[model samples]
Target: MQTFACQCGATLFFGNRKCVACGCDAGWCDVCRRMTAVSSDGHCLGPGCGAAVAPCGNRLAYDVCNAFVPQSATGETIRCRSCQLTSVAPDAGDPQNVHRWRLLEAAKRRLLYDFQTVGYPDAQLTAAPPLTFRFLADTPEKHVITGHADGVITINLAEADPVHRETARQQFGEPQRTLIGHMRHETGHFIWMREIEGQREDQSASVFGDHANPAYGDAMKTYYDHGPAADWPARFISKYASSHPWEDFAESFAFYLDMRSVLDTLRCQAPQLVGAGAGDLPTMLKSFQEAGVALNEVNRSLGLTDLVPEVVPPAVVAKLQFVHDLFQRYVAAT
Candidate 1:
C-alpha cells in the first residue's frame, strides 16, 4: 500500500473515500494511479462539465477505477476498464445492491492493489482477453458460480451473505475465509494462466508435479466423494491443494504472496529487517529463513500458528529460484 494526497496537500490513506482536510472526496485516477479530489456536486467527468464537477463519475459511479473514463464514453454508457471486471452488477438503485456492491468494490480494489505491487501482467500478456468480474444475483432460473474465464471473473452476490460464506467455510473446514482470500486465490489461478504457463509451466511440473499428471475433472470428483488425503498437511499447504496440479500451483502462488506480505509486515516492527533487502537469491533466502524462525518463535509464545507454513523445501526452492531469476531478468530488461 502507498500513501496518497489530495489536491489540498492533505495526507490520505489507502482505501479512503473522502479527504478530511479539504472536505473533498478522494478518487483514484486510473490513468496515472494518482489520487484526485472530487467535488461534491453530482456531475459527470465529461468535458462539457470541465473540472466543474470535482468528484468525477469515475469516483461517483464506481468506488475507484484504474482510470477515468473520458467524457466521450458517457454518451455510449460504456464501462470503464477497471469496472469492466463485473459481467454483472446488481441494479445500483436496488437496496441490496448498495451493500453488496460496496463489499465487492472494496475486495476488488485490494486485489488490484496487490496486483500492482507485484507487477503481475494481465491476460493481455498472452494475447488473451482482459479480465473482468461481475456480481450476479441469484434467480430461480440460474445459479451463480465464482470462477475466472478468459476475460472475466464472476462472483455470485449471495457469497457476500455472511451466513452463506460461513456455511461454506465450515463445510470446507477452512480456518478462515473472506472476500479478500477468494480474490487472492482466484487471481492466483489467472496469474498462473497468463504469466506462469508454457515454459514456466514445464518448470513447475518438474518441481510440483506433471501439470497433466492428474485428471482434474475426475480428481475433483474423487476429492469431494472420498475427502482429502490423510497426509494432506505434510505435502500440501491447504486441503484444496490436494485437488490437482493446477490447484496446487494456485495454492502455492497464493501462499508465496501471503508469506511475502506477512514477512514485510513484520519487518516494520523489527528493525533487523532493514538489511534483509540488500541481497541476491541465496542471500535473500537466508534472510527470509532467519526471519521466519524468529517470527515463528514469537508466534508460539503468543500461541499462534507459524505465520508461514514451512520453509521452501529443497524441491520447491528451485522453482521459487526460477521465479526470482525471471523477475531479476525482467527488471534488468526494463
Candidate 2:
C-alpha cells in the first residue's frame, strides 16, 4: 500500500479515521486515492470538485466504515463505493459482531485498494450480477465456510477475531492466515468467474486445467479426506490450492496480488532501492526472493520467525506469470 499524508502533514495510513497531529476527521478520497481532511461543512478538502461528502451510511449507522460518499448522491441512503458492495452484514445487535464486521470491512477495503492500484477495474456492484459480500456468523450447530458463489463472497465473521483465526491457522498448519488473505483469495474466484471464465478459457486451461471436469468435486473431496500430495510444494503455492483446478487458480491469483502489493509498497517507500523490477514477473520474483531472505534475517535478528515463510518455487512462479499476463490483458482491454 502507498503511504499517505494527512492534510496537516502528519503521516497517515489507509485505515486512519483521525489525523493525530491536526486532530481533524480524515477520510479516504476515492478520486484522489489519498487521505484528506473533511471540512466542517462536510466537503472533501482534497483535489477535484471539493464536493460536499458524507460519511458512509455504514459508518453513520454502525460506526464501522470510514469511506465517504458525495452528499448529493442519489438514493435513499448514501454508501461509499466500498460499502455498496456489501449485500448483507452480520447481526449488529451484538456488539462483538459489530466489531468483527468492522475488522472485516477494513481488510476488504485494503483488498479493494490493492486491486484498484494494480489497474483492475471495479466490477460495478450497481450493475447486474454485482459483486457483493455477506458476512455471516457461525452458529452453535454449524460452521460457516468462507467461499465465493456467483458474485457474492461470504465470510465467517469469526475470522476477524485474531484468536479464532490463529487457532484455525494452527489447526490447519498454515504458515500464514489473515482476513486480507481470505478476501484476496475469494476475489480471485469472483474475477475468474466474471472476467476470465469465458474470455481466457484456453489460456487458463493450459495452466490450471479445465474447470468443467467431472472429477472436480471428487478432487476436492479427496483433498479434504487425505490432504494434498506430499510433493504439492513442488507445484502448488499452498495445500488448499492442490484441491482443485479452480482453487489452484485462486491461490495463484491471490499470491500474485500479495506479491504485487508488497512490491509496490516497497518501491514507493524506498525508491532508491533498485533491482526489484516493478512490472516484470521474472525479475520481480528474483527481487522478491532476495528481499525475503534479507527480511527473514532481520526478523531472526529480532528473534522472530521469517516475515514471509513460503518459497515461490519455479512451477508456482510460472503460474504467477500466467496470472500477471491475464491481469495485463484485462487492464489493456479496459
- Write down the lDDT of every candidate, Cα atoms only: 0.62, 0.81
Per-residue lDDT tens digits for candidate 1, residues 235-298, read 6667887787777766666665554554444454564653444346566566667777877788
lDDT for model 1: 0.62
Residues 168-266 of candidate 2: C-alpha lDDT, one tens digit per residue = 988988878899899999988987887677788778878887777738778888988999989999989998888888999999888888877777777
Lowest lDDT 10-mer window, candidate 2?
A: 270-279
RMSD of 2: 2.2
Candidate 2 has a TM-score of 0.92
Kindly report which residue stretches of model 2 are placed more than 4 angstroms away from their true locations once superposed.
Answer: 73-77, 123-127, 273-277, 302-305
